[model samples]
Target: QEELAKKQAEALKIQKKNDELRAREEQRHLAKNTRVFELPLSRYKRKDDLKDIAACLGLDLNGKIPELTSRIKAHLDSNSVLQANPRFCGLFG
Candidate 1:
């Protein structure tokens, strides 16, 4: 009976952890989706700022600000198109 109780307690802890991870993932998804199309030019004032955005987008980070801006814009545009299409999303979603 003591062993069973310990196992049950462990299971409860694991279950709670899984629930917390699931909730965190859902929040991240919501935040990413919410900011998908709301890019403002004024937000990226410095070259480092643009580099950070480029790195997040998986673009080459070795470029001038204007080049980085264009690359990020292009990537965002393509992603937005894919996101806007329900068929494309359903295939991989």
Candidate 2:
């Protein structure tokens, strides 16, 4: 009984470690495939154009211009492109 319990605990620990590794790999894969775009704030001036772009990008603007702006800001904050391009800040602001 003691040996069986030890084996079971060891198996569970290995499974947990494997699951964590798999999750980390998936996160890296997703990050690699993610595309970042720089959208001009002027696009928002035209509601229809903004909506069209958001739809094409699979973003849910939901007719809310402010929410779209926020999403753009959030993406830029986490992405490297924004750091490399000062012009992007001006364009989006």
TM-score of each: 0.43, 0.37
The digit string of per-residue lDDT tens for model 2 on 42-72 reads 5555554454444434556565677776665
Candidate 1 per-residue lDDT, tens place, 6-91, comes to: 99999999999999978855654454433342346446668855665555456787888889888877876668665454422321
RMSD of each: 11.9, 12.7
Q: Please provide the root mean square deviation of candidate 1 (C-alpha atoms, Å).
A: 11.9
lDDT of 2 at 90: 43
Off by over 4 Å in 1: 1-39, 81-93
lDDT of each: 0.62, 0.57
